[model samples]
Target: MEKVSEKVRQIIQPGEHSYVFSKYLEPIAHVKPGEVVEIYTKDAFENRITSEKDLPSQILGDYLNPQTGPIYIDGAEPGDTLVVHIIDIEPDRDWAVSVMKESFGGLTSTDLTPMLQDPLPEKVWIYKIEDGMVRCNDQLNFPLRPFLGTIGTAPEVEALSALTPFNHGGNMDVPDTKPGNKVYLPVRTEGAFFFTGDAHAGQGDGELCGVALEISARVRLKFELIKNKEIKWPRIESDSEYMVVGSARPMEDAARIAYSELIKWMEEMGWDKFEAYQALTQIGKLHVGNMVDTYYSLVAKIDKKYTKLD
Candidate 1:
């Protein structure tokens, strides 16, 4: 009798680094619930800022970000959903820090820095967790929930508008994309061109400074299909809730886009417009996805109780 084979596969190519995609490969044999798969990822710096001396070039040149893997999963098709379970995230280094350059950071014109006095290879920032609060420097402390600042797929064109999360998921910086969370992205092409980058050691809601801890990461994802369900934008289901994530030019407009998408979700779950609005109104809250990008993103989460049919 022939033995039944387990469907396990690795998506990324070996020993390759920075700005290159793994050549097309066969899809994973099968993906079932409770199954897990590990993915190797490159740091957001993309091997540009390896040493203290290499930091200057990292900020000045390199106009854009490069990501990896648009891995196609078996039995995944358009109008279906892909469940990306983030089981673990381990960084290569002990500490990760980000420095905001004078002209480049999100707060480009604010009084963020006292003065521009010196030029160093890179700036330094630190953190302290005490009394259940996470603090950067001495003034800011947030409940420490670190996430992937940049996790998305490629756009139709190779060179997407730098710093935006398009239909094909370029730079959607959602803080809730943390460990033990599941990010569901819409599949634009035959094999969803998935790319994961911008792993942060820690971050705030907006990533106001324009960067996260900026480190390399190790992650595991489990892909599953949501059949007979059609979603227009990215939707996520974490341990406790479901959210519709969308992006647009202005912040307020972005929030509306996300909210509208969530309404679609409500309708699909058999709620009328009034019922959907009421259900969402009770549980929905908007998130400032990423303000620094050219076009910002907003995610609307409809609490699990609203969607769970028991």
Candidate 2:
């Protein structure tokens, strides 16, 4: 985590044409490791829907989740690991919104899950924010915990949509991707084309409605490089535990991948392989990051104290 003496903290914003995250895309900005940056990102709809008559399906034309950049971090290269420390995420506006399109969401009818009934109506929900909580209704209130819905590096593939989360990390929508959390992503391209977008003011575990409290935000973060770490999936480090993230079609397989990576990490910390597995089986906690994404994301977590090999 080398520090740079640049006088200003670079702030990046997505231009009108900035639409996707792909390895072929050129970097909009470059900063050395440990250089702090601020990002101003549009909501998933490009912040075009302002009234009740506006529909999410109609607004999301070719642009899916709008991203701020593929910022280049110098000295990062393939076979290394890129570490991102989320410094802060604050809602840019006073209100946030969520939507259910023609056939999206966990419980709604979709092309993937055919039903004999008509598709659900396009609905939208606006939550008023104050006192650090969103007022959904008299009985339902959600606390404000802002996070990025998509944070990923360009994969080795030519161009992958920002819809799926994989080794390079995309729209994982994990609430754990918050302030003070550390996310580890593999470096596939030189400088690790890291991109972020789709800020959510608050989200439930499954995102059952396919949308959270979508809001614009000022995201503050810093980057570092872990040379030669060679990790497979994205990992997260919180105050109390370490989490391995896996995203796949069947949630069971995603859970398997998360557990698999956690075990590998434990083994790397010098514990006996069998003992690590046994310890994890007894103490590991499984978390659902998002069940509404194209690929379900699961996280396996264990306390650092239990992972001490010495």
Candidate 3:
């Protein structure tokens, strides 16, 4: 609740963080639609693993992905669509961390994918961020592509952990939830308790090792509301593509949910359902969000040109 700027309507500090998304949590701040707010967030591990010497087994707590808010939008109600336009995301620190947990990640032996084999080694990699690049070491480096790993509205009755992603949009970890994109979330509860955190400097598809270049961030976002317009799943709009996200188990189910939702959206926009399905089969693109979370997330996307209706 520290006030950092007079220009920003609301400034939520890292102290105003939560581990779960629930309607029971008090609103940290309330804002009218169209207000620009700046939020400061901790990394996925809550900034616990600072160096390569810090291992997940020794430092991580019972919870991860500490979200920043349950910010109440003035007029948002059930069945409305909450639109969040990400204006910018700046890394608050010069370093980020990635880790490999013992019983986690895509290739490791997880509780969901049990195996007689031993667990993977618990290790951490600290990446240096300089000149807008994340340097893993002298041999590899990539441009920083910061995005929110967990961003969503609360569900009607469930108090879900920040680690899971589903219809309510927790921890989807989609790379598309970055700057210059508008994320549409379904509001199932009054006020649409919104929370976001788990900033990543960069992450590849599937979030391969179950971690990204986790970094603290200064995120600026604008909120808007679509009265009475209900969406079943999270949707994204970038400069040229329209995307829908679906989180489920057995990756293929996630893909089906994403594609099905996209087809339904196209139908609502006036395209015939069968034609839309056929068109999507030929031109749709699927991007893996995260294969490491409790549920895998897949994004179905199509370029704007193909979405233009006569």
Candidate 4:
């Protein structure tokens, strides 16, 4: 990971953080469109629960992911679109953490999915970062794949928890929220109250255990506003694909919402509704974001070639 340079127009340190997305929270800093900014973020655990002996049930509080800011974007207003271009994400620490707590994982007897059986035993695994790889164990090492786990603009009236992912885009945990991708969020209040955090050094699809390679990070981002371009859900654009995220209960519902939103976006881009639905039926791809949060998240994606008019 390269060091942040002087070219950044603003630097938001992880001094004051928030655990909820609310229109009422005071703006940490104000930024204009097209200005580059650097944000520092803590891991999902907020750097608590360091070793195997530090049990999450004892060390952690009610909140999990601590977000950096509710950055007020100049000229942004309700019904507008906030465009975030991720420039880069670099791990701020040499080590990362992942853990399994009692009744907290997807496969375990979580509070949402109560089972009569016993919950999974708690455990912790601290991964080492070296040579651009995350050393999981002595025998396994994989390349770094950094991304933000929670990111979104505030909802108009609700003060939602940072762990919840909904229309306002909270803890989606989608690995696609990485460097080089552009995330488009709907603005529900003035200035778009943007918040982001929960840096993952790496994660697999579905974030199976309800955790990833949690790490602190320095993220570079650029903001832009698209006036009057309101989207129902968060949309992501990469060099090759266009993706939309949806969060809901009953995993299948999340999938349906994602596909529905993708089809709607396609219709807005000139494809007939039926045609877009048919096209998606033939070529759309699905990526699981998380199955362990308050609401499960799914991403519907399609290649850019399929959307071309030529």
lDDT of each: 0.62, 0.83, 0.91, 0.90
Residue pairs in collision within model 4: none
Better of 1 and 2 by TM-score: 2
| Model 1 alpha-carbon drift over 4 Å, by segment | 1-35, 50-60, 109-122, 126-144, 155-162, 308-310
Candidate 3, run of 10 with poorest lDDT: 1-10
Residue pairs in clash, model 3? none
Predicted candidate 4 versus true structure: per-residue lDDT over 232-301, tens digit per residue: 9999999999999999999899999999999999988899999999999999999899999999999999
Worst 10 residues of 1 by lDDT: 20-29
Instruction: List where candidate 2 sits over 4 angstroms from the true fold.
Output: 1-8
Which candidate model has the greater TM-score, 2 or 3?
A: 3
Alpha carbon RMSD to native, model 3:
2.9
lDDT of 1 at 172: 71
Tens-digit lDDT track for model 2 on 1-310?
Answer: 2233444475666455355567787788887887788788888887887666688767668557888888888999999999998888878888888887877788867767667777789977778889999876787588888988889888877676776777678989888888888999999988888899899998888888788889988888888899988999999998889999999989999999999999998888887878978998899999888887778899899999888754
After superposition, which runs of candidate 3 have C-alpha atoms over 4 Å from their true positions? 1-6, 13-16
Candidate 1: give its CA RMSD in angstroms: 6.1
Task: Sort by lDDT, best first.
Answer: 3, 4, 2, 1
| Model 4 regions lying over 4 Å from their true place | 1-6, 13-15
